[model samples]
Target chain A: MNRPKKIKPWWGILPVAIFLAFWEAAARLNLMPGHLFLPPFSVVMQESYHLIASGVLIENFLSSLARVVIGFCSGAIAGLIIGGLMGWKEVLNKAFSPMISLLYPIPALGWLPLLMLWIGINEALPIAIIFICCFFPICYNTAAGIKSVDRNLIQAARTLGAADFRIMITIVLPLALPAVFTGLRLEAGMAWKVVIAAEMVAIPTGIGALLMRAESLIRVDIILVCLMVLSFMCFFFERFFLYLEDKLTGQWNQHAGY
Target chain B: MPAIELRNIRNYACHGVNLEVFSGELMVLLGPNGAGKTTLLNIIAGLAGYDGSVLFDGAPVDGVSPQKRRVGYLFQDLALFPHFAVASNIAYSLKANRWSGEKIEARVGELLDLMRINHLVSRYPHQLSGGERQRVALARALSLSPAILLLDEPLSSLDLHTSKYLRIELKQLQQRLDITTLHVTHDLGEAEEMADRIAIIHEGRIEQVGRPQEVFFYPANEKVAAFIGAPNILQCDKTRALGHGLVEVTCGGLPIVVPYDGDSIRKIALFPRDIYVSLHKPPGPKVNRFKGVISRIKDLSESIRLVVHAGNNQLLAEMPRHTFESMGLVAGQEIFLILKLAKIKVCEGGLCEQGDSK
Candidate 1:
């Protein structure tokens, strides 16, 4: 008797429920040892609560979060400046864009050994690695943003008597903000990923370190806890990014969304 | 004193073009597509690079940049900043000129009032309709108080109805502002409506410049005559002078007396409206009448345009719609043309022979 919408909200929740139920049934039925496989969603939820209550878990979580934020912020700032310069001047774009591409393809984790050799086992190693990982996306996006501004807007500014720097400040920056935000979204996620990798080897302090420790002790439950924490961080940041993106790009969508 | 003088100005697209625009005059630059009308405007505004000098109030302007030249330009597309509100767009010029905050606000407010868009000041450029956006663009240009305003086909993109309305507003605003202007358009109607003087540019060269009446009445050559709406250009061999601004020419093996005051090989131009049509050849010595068979009869409001094949020449005449109806005029119908000599302009050579070719 009810008119069903094309896409029902509750329909999306079905797949997650099925996945958890399958895992729980398999573990409880002893398809695999409960200790080795960690018995599914209920067990993981219980472990999450226990981990949160422990001060060590809270400390590691905060440390990882802090690393991501600091690295992403620094990297994004550098990206903005470099990208703006590259976009504005053809000479600069030629000079620096190739250098960026050269460094971009090398994996972020590839520098972990070099960073450790330089900064040693400290937070700097992880933060620096995260910063490096976030840099390329942010920088390239910013440059593209500036270049992509409608040429008519620039012409209008010139006719209004705007000088060079003023044009860049008032017209170019605002127009490029959407692209910068896009870069930020991508870079922020990269920074979080970098933090995990750095924490595992160089610093040994956060979720990645916890996963490594659990693996050495042959405790799959704790390892699953570390992964759950990482997944939660990615999910939380992605949501926050989407919120910001929606606020900025929703109106612009009508004009140039495609 | 001239408000703006372009001396031997040569640039890409447009060659050396010399022009002088007096203060407070609305000068319309008329041209066909790719005649370099826009290039001339851009060179004056410093938007494009060019050779030679553009003097604003007797000072050389080539050394000055676009912002420093103080010339306001409205591109064909009306390049209004899409990101800024209308008020902000107008105020941008003032801000760039380093006016104080209160001064900028007062100037912007006055322009918004002048442009009749005080209600839409907060709205962005994209939000404005075609006509509203045009007014905003004009207001933005005027805010700078430039030496001369360059309007590049300001109404070209609008619908026919919108263009007509904007043309009236633009003409009124130009007079009210008392700013020297260089307006460019390919439309003869627009030139007739807005120009104090018309300059017809063709192929990067100014083909002719004079008062609209002078250009329309006495076009220098065939090209200028055709461009200014001279519908009938009859190729005739002049046989003898009929005396007192009249000449007898053998057109299509038929000798037709035309009003020709000039000497040598003549290309006779006649306005379709000047040529009257009659059902029967009316008897009058005062009127020059010739019988012809109507080949094409186009019904236009107020008047009927008739293309008549008289002997070897195709003669076009216009009469009131009722006259054609009363006469029962149709295609293949025979009619007589009452030719008026005063309305006919005779040019000796072509468009290129005269006007600045070098």
Candidate 2:
């Protein structure tokens, strides 16, 4: 019975259209001052088609996406388990909170050189880096989400004959879902960023490597093409997460801020 | 229906509290704030650690966990699951107890109909009005058909009209269900309204447990007398026997005749609503009548409260707004006040022992 609201699609794309038109005009007029480095929008589009036809773009895009998915899923699952335990049991929280606090402040990329030495510059290296990036935010947010559950709700559950495990599953977890989704959305974006950086430094495949290759050859259009692909992928993941969050926890969104 | 008995129950907030709530009775635990009324309820529900035994229908449930004890608790905040719709909230216990899907659905539908919230089954807690939310909470508490119901100030947060309405509804529901209930509230009006038997608790101990009229008119001690809104407590200066089950006591330069008891009287307690005020003195026995001038007037919405200065005493008297208007009363006006002789509660040695006065 519910219908989606109508939206004017052009309103979303107007800014991109204006920027593209300006770039094409600048390049057509031969506007100097690093004009060679700044490729025209049309040139980037043409290069994109070439890369796609040759299967290079698809190959790198899939490889990067695979690493992000594997890393993000593994990190998110581990975060959920550890965070749930910590949040539920005070002893576990006390034992692990200090260590988590100590390590969380270090940037994900800060672990790269050591991870490259340990993981040896392969697919595992980028995946591990992305995993590190995804872990902390998800873990911290999950623990906080569980901790913030109303005590009265737990008491109400107890008086209703709900066992401890049932209370956790039915009351605590569902109440914490909105915060968990917040953590997931945050780490999803971080996973993409970390995977690209890791692929550039420690792996030979993916969009990041394609950018590195274009940089060495001074092929600015190829660099522009890689940037566009990364931008689209980031946008796609963000929208996907937002859609998932809304679908799963839309009823609680108004109260999630509490 | 199970009779709940707490024997010498000791906890962090409450100590050495002994009380019994009879089967199928709504016993209101009336107290001021920090009086451990909620702690006693928690002890009965097995949610709090206590030093003494809690018995249900004369069987000890000391070691029972809260979930297995079958106590339905309606928290002061109601604590309806914000994430669940009304149907889900009511079905929570049934689902927890592993009731079949069909049974859960049937019971939820039955409760929705009972609480008169069938149309709200699909709505979330935040989407409902205050009264609707309260009904949902009550329905959820009664979902498992719990043996004993513990309500902690359930109607304290409601508007006056809604609170009054729900008090009647709750009392009727409790009677129809025939469930033993321990209802805690700091509001005297609520306790008087909903209680079958009222237990006045102060400083973690039960001062008195009796019928509502007995506890109101004949408080067991000074603390219960003070907490139950006896606004005219005066220190007795002297007392003399009047020879026919009556004694004359001078309190703050005002001589009042009260029921005679053997123990020495030190103070006298009078409820504001029991005092009669009039513009002109009518034909009466004049046992405890005195001429007084109204010092201050307060409008209490339904009634008018006057501070009457009689001799060296300041007494609070309340009457219906219509009565006050008909008398054409104002501040500084002289009036004759009659303190009902039998209703004047006399305290002996700072404590009013039970059955000391009629």
Candidate 3:
């Protein structure tokens, strides 16, 4: 007889419920200052209900989302073109590889001092940080993906009489699109994390800025509400991105052969 | 006019590979592994660099690119693009050649019908069977209707039954289209079955080029003889020239006569089935009779292969299983074999000089 799994798939929800219960207990029992420092789960929930009712949540939500979307698009587009050129052309690779390697290792937040100096206390600063955060993964993955395209496909296309340029765009690019999308998803996650940090540090209107303001005001329930809302937003976006990817890949599978 | 005339084409894999393929005929480049058969095809297709000129329809094509040379090439590995549907795979070349969408659609449909996989139009290459893949590759090559078609072992990747079926179909298709084709294959059977002319390549060189029957019945050299699956290539010890185009030679210390030419009659190949085998030595005078023993017998699907051990030589012979069974031929049984003076081929240069064959 087969032994049943010690933790069933449904058991995955248990940890989150248990953690919220523990927090509620700790706050209600006065292990910490419930009103000023640490709020019970119920208190955070009540505060979140009010925040959503008043439309503050949606406003802060859109503010953060707009920054991430604009920054990510700019960064991903730039990365794709640069990475594609570097991967396909030797001269471009030699020219840009050295510079990219030098800059890629620095964390997205580490550029905060530089961005603040150059762009100086505006929405563009946080957007630039998100862009930098998203850029490297997309760029690196795209380049590697392009480089790893099956040489046989390229050769077959050429012999099939596809000109040099058409072969790259039609065959090589589509073949590497999956890897590029993988990079996009990875960078998206990074973009969310970095943009939040940027908003907390510099921006005044996003969810991260709300969390910073709550910290100074000692509104512990508001801080917990901000964390909960941001998690939900990021989770929703990830799921939405995945759904879009499945649709795109499903269409692609109709023609895929190799 | 010849479809392809390779004049003294020399490269590392090919050495002075001169060949003339007549229009509307299949010329097979037959060789063993690394014999440069594919390289020769590549050179003619303008996919490889070579020194000597390749003339297509009496006009030199060396300066042209592979695309401009207008030769359809079926790669040995098939090289089917994975991201295209079966119909689109065939249409790719037409699209590349700048045929209008309407023309491409018509050509693709025609090729799909000709290759007989119209049902598989929407199917991807990964979803195809081996035979389906072969047909798709051939269809993809023939879509644009180039002047010359080059096949590099088109059927090597299929099973025996599939290979046999496709071989006949490809030959028929080639005949119908009347497109000049150069086919490369390591299998002599494929060459024999499909080629109008066979060019036996060896060591990066053209050893012999002749009609299929000529190459089979009368291989130009010992290497050609061995390579053609003669199974009875013998080294001659002594040779005596007689006038009127005849020569007497000793094969494995047994006297044999051959209608020969040239100074040195060093070796010869005799087709095994052509030699008559019997248990009893005949009373009449035999011209080329040799005493040997059946060392081994293999029961094949339809034939029984017998390995006979004559003096200083081993000969392989095959006969119908029923006949072999009726004759009660057994291994280790002493036998007498007869070689007709007419059914022998004189290998101009002995295989001993070739040295590669063990």
Identify the candidate with maximal TM-score.
2
Model 3 global lDDT (CA atoms, 0 to 1):
0.83
**Fnat of model 1, as a fraction:** 0.55
Model 1 Cα lDDT, one tens digit per residue, A1-258: 887868978899999889889888887778876456565667877777888887767888888998898888898889889999999998999999889999988888999888888988887888888888888888899999999988767776786789989999988888887788778876776777778877777567887788788789886777887887888788778667767766765543343332
Model 1, global lDDT:
0.81
**DockQ score for candidate 2:** 0.56
TM-score of each: 0.77, 0.82, 0.75
Task: State the TM-score of the second chain for every model.
Answer: 0.70, 0.71, 0.70
Which ten residues in a row are the worst by lDDT in model 1 chain A?
A249-258
What DockQ class does candidate 1 belong to? acceptable
Provide per-model DockQ scores.
Answer: 0.34, 0.56, 0.28
Candidate that scores best on lDDT: 2
Q: Please write out the lDDT profile of model 3 over residues B68-151, one tens digit for every residue.
A: 777888998898877788988898888888999999898888988899999999988889999999999999988778889999
User: For candidate 1, lDDT tens digit of each residue in B1-358?
Assistant: 7999988888778777889899999999998788999889889888788888999988888988777888888988887766677888888888888999999999988888898899998888778899999999989988978869999999989988999988998899889889999999987768977999999888887878899866776677777865664557666685688798777776666676767665554456666777887787688684467788999987756567888988788877877687778878789877777877666556554522322131
List the candidate numbers ranked by TM-score, top first: 2, 1, 3
TM-score of chain A of each: 0.90, 0.93, 0.86
